[model samples]
Target: MAIPRLRPLLLVAVLLLRAFASLPTQAAARGGLDPSPGIADRKHGSSSRSLLQDQPEITEEMVRGYMSNFELESAIQDFGRRCANISRTYSIGKSVNGSPLWAIEISDKPGQREAEPAFKFIGNVHGDEPVGREVLMQLAYWLCDNYLKDPLAALIVENTHLHILPSMNPDGFALRRRGNANNVDLNRDFPDQFFPNNDDIKHRQPETRAIMNWIKQEHFTASASLHGGALVANYPWDGSRDTRKQYYGCPDDKTFRYMASLYSQSHYNMSLSKEFEGGITNGALWYPIYGGMQDWNYIHGGCFELTLEISDVKWPKASELLVIWKQNKMSMLNLVASLVKTGVHGRIFAADTGRPIPGSLMVKGIDSKINASGSFGDYHRILAPGQSYEVVASMEGYRPKRTRVMLGREATNLDFILDPDGAVRRTKPLRNDCGCSCNDNSNTGKPFLLREAYLWLYLLALFFLLALYLLFRRRMALRLAAHRHPPPKRPVAV
Candidate 1:
């Protein structure tokens, strides 16, 4: 009995010793992932001190030249008035402090919806990160000042619908904090893909709710949000499924890597960063954070988003803001231009009626699928260049159409006309989202199926009613004959 007890203790001791021995190896195998406050002032690393309070405290003097909430609103109004022809300013929603979350729309036809790819630039996600807000205003001004004069500006304005929201959290900006007036971190407030513990959308903050609703309404092709305290473009899969700090990538990992590389290389010195390789890092590989906006946008919004840290310090001197804008100008312009300059864009249509079909799209190996707009049936897909991909367009009542194309540096146009598969036709109604029915012919599969089912039901009901009437008349006639002629004899059997 004593030997058996000793044997169990010995086994437990050996297991403990092995676990202790493997600890250093696991940390060391991570290579140069060691993060500390001294490496950089930015709060981006695995170091506890870096994560806690790496950023210095903001002073009123430091933020002297920055625009106040009132000043920013005035600047937006000024831009709209100055460039009313190609730009329209509207409020997406109101913030916690009742500040209007203003957005600028820059396009040839500002308010009209065309078969064009849409891109949005959201700035000042954290109140303390004010660099984005100022830089975005400068971007709006630049586009307005150089629309027809500059080739790049005209390409962006004529091709893509660029929406810019200069300040996402005015309340936080006023409070000089990371969180909003409610003291909630907006970056960590989005619905998490890995953790569904607090995934209730209704309970989210108002600022977050506005962004969610905006994404649902718009068919954005791709977007990027601005943040400070680092100089790297962080791409999707921000959190690992097992909650481990490792390089976990999404299905569109290759395309995301390409996009991140593009932005970094376009920047002045981002590509030459000593900390990040090629000045681009996977979100989870850098430092995993749950409920991040980057992962949510890619997973749910059908929009490719990147978290761009354009500065080394969170709260730099206000004078450096302009210099920072100049550094990131080309990167911003190139990103917006890439929406139309590169990618696969086309419309899906029905073979029979030649009408637009609101179909979903898929690439051969990618796991994600994007939807086309119901009105124009236009879809924009971003893929890595210099590659051949089989793009599939699928709808419920139509046979999917696939085409293989070798994509190049320039955008490719490949329209698909799918034949209606009557064998698999469903009763889904055809939506006329253009506010007016343009076709008088009621020959769509949806209406035809409904009418066919109704006709069968009507015929069946008529047959049953006729059979019941005949039976009633025959019984009435038998009663009448019985009444006319009296019964002579009746035999009772016991």
Candidate 2:
């Protein structure tokens, strides 16, 4: 039976309704995602919104006016030549029509070279969602152009290795189609290795192959794929159901929630109360999507993946591109910065046996908080410093843990071995219960992990190696091809 096709506008509206309804419950219970600390109750008036909502509409005319064929090619080439240090090129496999699948790497540190965690900002996975391409391009340009002028830009590029494949489905991009040239949905092609894919079987597309290959080759810390026509950020590892029945959570669901909430706070203005006004966990803005880029990245790639629907429609007007960019730019910056900050470092184990506890922990300080380390023995929290703070650590079959730590000149490392009696211990909920301590933001936050000086040196080394490789290989390949062509017969025939 043929599936009924819906109009683009209707489909998007429906998707939004379904997504909004599916926002996870804010209950701090089993299989529920909770909101982090420092989540403001009210919007930051107009200034905050104005800063993010800079780009209003992206019309087709606007896209065509600035983003021409020549400009697209030039952007790709310029990225290859100018930003050679922070990135490398790879094949995404092939397209349906047999084209070279190209992906650009944007790592602050190399694969062999160890540093902070890595991330990939993939765009145009659906081909027609072209707004992501613009976002990625603008981000890269800003990073390169303001490497020295902007401290934040330089900080992000220096500490983080950001891999970006701005356009994943060039064939569909060329055709202006949502699906690939083969008419298959590229977003629905990821194979579920950890859990079985419960939806319709539509695996094994070329674009999927390329992404899978890249992910398998280089393990990233987190990733976000850009989509258009939706004004929400989706995170996960589920098959359209964000519950225990379909997709409960990732091993690092707590961390995913922390990061996703950060993006939401910085951009979407979505509070816990309004997060689920659309749906439960199935067909809403906050629902889980199975066989999705985010899910696959979380389960298979071991990286946190988020599906960022930039606009309110699948095909927003090109004029809205810049507006979406403004909305997303800072959120993206915050996410990268948080990932590199290397939050509160501590140890978690059994108080009785001093055995390590393998589970999740949450630590809250001032206006920022962090999810502790994935490794149970030792944990780290990424935080924004200043003010007296509190911490909480909990895992299944153990009593919840809470304490306070002060941030100052040194990295705060607290060691906790849970009591054997903690399994049955009942604890009271600790809030900012008192106004006793002083609240001050006088001191600026510090980088907990990779320092700026070391980060720049690493980025410098990465670009230097990339330059030598490209120069030497291009020269060799050109010479070999020239030898085979016999100097083009000296153009004598003309």
Candidate 3:
């Protein structure tokens, strides 16, 4: 009996050691193991050999149809020339390997600042996920080819400024790896809300720094980053305070849910997914991830962002890209259209000066605050429709204004005109140039003036009587003169 028990205990210890050995040491440093279903935990030191052995080798025939980094850049430049009237191409920054991170801006006014809301679509955040970059180029070509012919395309181009960054990790894509040339996960390099590990900007990767700076430069109202290995529209808060795997919603939980559903319900079959209900999920619920770009966007950039897992396979055949694009076309269009179709957009102004004021906008019960554009004082606040909200606009030197609005299915325009604090005292009194005493000051008359008022009244009465007598005498004299003058006028007529 003792020998059997010892043998069982030894076998259990051996199994435990093997299990521990399988987990890489870096897993603990990246905020414990990721429990997200269906997603390979490549960030946590998943073995490259095992990953490579699992997937079929990518042959030359496999990549023949796909655009390389060089081809993608050339295609973007060609698109810029082809659709120069409505679109322009520019590079935000270069990757660590000196690959230009190109961005195609599509709008009626490409580089000009307008009062309209801006939306950005970032693709290929991970190098191994090359589907996004291809799909993005297709999206650009589709919009360019069907602007006036398609009503939805016309609406997007006319109403909103759309920016597309095809591949954010060109170096990683070139190296045929998940991370950049530095081997750092771009998605996990953002400043985490709950963790201090990635808070230092100096240690951030170059791509992460470029994105952060780009957000600061452009006031994007909403954005989305594309990824692969699953089909779900993921919204924030991506990480939790305790780092536990649970459902964590951000401040704009309802609006984000509506946004996610808009993308999923419009998709061909994303809503039919058995894994994700409606092909949408809260990031933390799926699995808590620290230093994610989605949560950081909401917390720091004030941009409502979604991390979209667009494909089930990270590297699908190049020929299948068009089918994938077709499946996601409506979803992408609807997601961008939601910005114009379902938000409160307006400008704040000073009442006295009638000039725009860069004030802060806040909802009564909501914890978040969206600031107006510095130049135009314009703001686009995304909220769930069919509800009433107490919207407040505030400025430092101006009196805050609040309005009760009942938002319906359509977008609402609510502009606030704030009055300067203590404006009433500075107001000028109206002038009475007619010389009439409209205001009565008799109650506050001087003490001596009150006593002398009767004497002055009597003197005024005597003078008035004398003047009446004089007027009567003069009228009697004038009547006699008129009687004499009338007879002469009759003779002149004859």
| Best prediction by TM-score | 1
Evaluate residue 400 in candidate 2 and report its C-alpha lDDT on the 0 to 100 scale: 50
In order of appearance, the predictions have TM-scores of: 0.76, 0.55, 0.76
lDDT of 1 by residue, 346-394 (tens): 7777755656778988998999999988877888888888998877888
- Higher-lDDT candidate among 2 and 3? 3
lDDT against true structure, model 2: 0.55
Question: Model 2, 237: alpha-carbon shift in Å?
Answer: 3.6
Which of the two, 1 or 2, has more TM-score?
1
lDDT string for model 3 (89-206, tens) is 9999999988999999999999998778889999989888888999999999999999989998998998889999999999998877788999988888887767664656888899
By lDDT, who's the top model here? 1
lDDT of each: 0.78, 0.55, 0.77
RMSD per candidate (Å) reads 21.2, 26.0, 25.9
